[model samples]
Target: MTVEYRPIVPKIKRFKILVIKIVFIVLGRAFQSASQHDEEIKREISSWRDGFTLIMKVMPDGPYMGLEKKNNMLEFKGSKLKQADLEIYFRNVESAFMIMTPQMGSHQAFAEKRMSIKGDLGIATAFTRALVIVMSVLYPEFIVKRLVKRVPPLTIKRAGLRVWLYTLGIVLGR
Candidate 1:
């Protein structure tokens, strides 16, 4: 009897790539929209290496999102860049989703060994803080509280600004 053998790894890789692309698209929109209206976000993004790329990936050769900060703007491209200043790797797709969905905070994911980061510590920390700020602008207060290690106090003005930024983000198809 003859039997057919098929590898599932390729299919899994494709799925992971699709998920990562979708996530990055949403994140890219959020960053671009927030930067336009929030000086703090613009400043934070500008601190990075000009044209520097940050890639977030699911490890074991999974999918990745390549993000570049240039001209004080954050943009996401479909494919991985040749080089990245920072690479944040999740052990697997589930691990990536756990943190991305706000079910587990990023700090908790790192503490639990679900993530591996390669880059300068200082730059990574600053980038993380910038992500937190971006999250605050993208998501609701309760969601942000769950996703971040520490939720900063939000003033009325800042909250109102977030609302406007979010509206702009949606309008811009972010």
Candidate 2:
């Protein structure tokens, strides 16, 4: 007796579903880890004990959010904090993450008005310096191209350059 083999469409469907589930789980874990990292940074900053409220209103729109770390507890508006004393402002979500990264200064996004820095100008400067320290300590971007390559895709690299040129022109009183 000969046994007949059947084509397995159902099996293929099941395999696709399994793959989708696995992908979702992996991505979810990555996002959670990133958020936890943000939280850890916030906690570390709070340790500084500034005792001043940093109200960061995401501009060109009225998000109206604030970061206040009076004591050990770090509180934010809407209870949507995964981090501490640092308040991020960006034109969009992608730019926000990019600015958070080290070697970020080369990117046009930071130089442009797209990402604005508000509150505690001294602390903001300190934060960037501290980031440099942390980056140097943890993972140094010694390789030039490797660091520059990580810059996010801005709509126009020329935009930042133009702003720089215009600023220089004004300073020179042209």
Predicted model with the maximum TM-score? 1
**lDDT tens readout by residue for model 1, 19-71:** 66576667766766666656666777666777888887777776676778767
| Model 2, runs deviating above 4 Å | 1-49, 53-86, 100-103, 106-108, 143-174
| Candidate 2 lDDT | 0.39
- In order, candidate lDDTs are 0.72, 0.39
Tens digit per residue, CA lDDT, model 2, 1-174: 999999866223344334433422322222222222334344446545645444333333423334444444323333243333455466643343343332344235456765667556666654444333223223334632343434222224334422432444223311
List clash counts for every candidate, in order. Answer: 0, 2
The 10 consecutive residues of candidate 2 with the worst lDDT sum are 26-35
